[model samples]
Target: MDFTPPQKRKAEESIVPMINVVFLLLIFFLMTSQITPPEPFEVTLPVSETLGDAESELTLHLSKDGDVQFEDFTGETAWMRLGGRIDPQTVVKLRVDAALPAPKLAQVMQRLSPTGAASVEIVAVQK
Candidate 1:
């Protein structure tokens, strides 16, 4: 038997593989994720007693100041831009501020008519 005791082996565990796996998973999630578009602006919708399920491909937002916005455009120009994009057979969703006057809302509806939208749905929050 040897006089000296056997040397203890270093208990080293490699973590590089674990780190690589974590990074790969992070990249996978980032690549597969879908991001939703942000709202154009803040809006206070009117209250309604009856809620209906309505879906539309196009949306027009009306601010309390009587300004109409669609996508990145505003005012009359926005309406003109929207007219070009509207489909005759698709419904248009209108989100108007509750504080907006009725006449302003009517004006927006009138402008939409020339676009030949099949229908218009006014969006309102349930009471």
Candidate 2:
């Protein structure tokens, strides 16, 4: 039987285009993703040049009306009903309206300060 060698199949093309497309998609997503800024409450905060030194792993906010809110890692509301996940081992940032009465603020601060909280910083909103 006369058999010519079966025609050799063309070698597979390189996947570089597919890889590039994937990388481009990844970069596009990274750039296009929306980033939420910090929430705005009604009261204005006092500014401090030294405030630049204030850093926190978690943030708690006390509104002027005596309402409390918490911020999660994504900087979104931690949900008062669901409560918050605070690690006592780390510093929790406390933001209070400048107008809130000191005793109320102190009580709130005491409640916030648990064994794991590394430190407490009372932050005032900037006007």
The numbered model that scores best in lDDT is 1
The positional error of residue 15 in candidate 2, measured at the CA in angstroms, is: 29
For each candidate, give its TM-score against the true structure: 0.77, 0.55
**Residue range 79-123, candidate 2, lDDT tens digits:** 432134555557777777777888988777666554356677777
Give lDDT: candidate 1, residue 80. 86
**Alpha-carbon lDDT, every model:** 0.88, 0.66
> Tens digits of per-residue lDDT for model 1 on 1-127?
7799889999999999999999999999999998757777788999999999779868899889888888888887888888888887879999899999999888888878888999999999999
Candidate 2, residue 38: the lDDT equals 67
Candidate 1 residues lying further than 4 Å off, grouped into runs, are 1-25
| Alpha-carbon RMSD, candidate 2 | 8.9
lDDT of 2: 0.66
Model 2 lowest lDDT segment of ten:
73-82
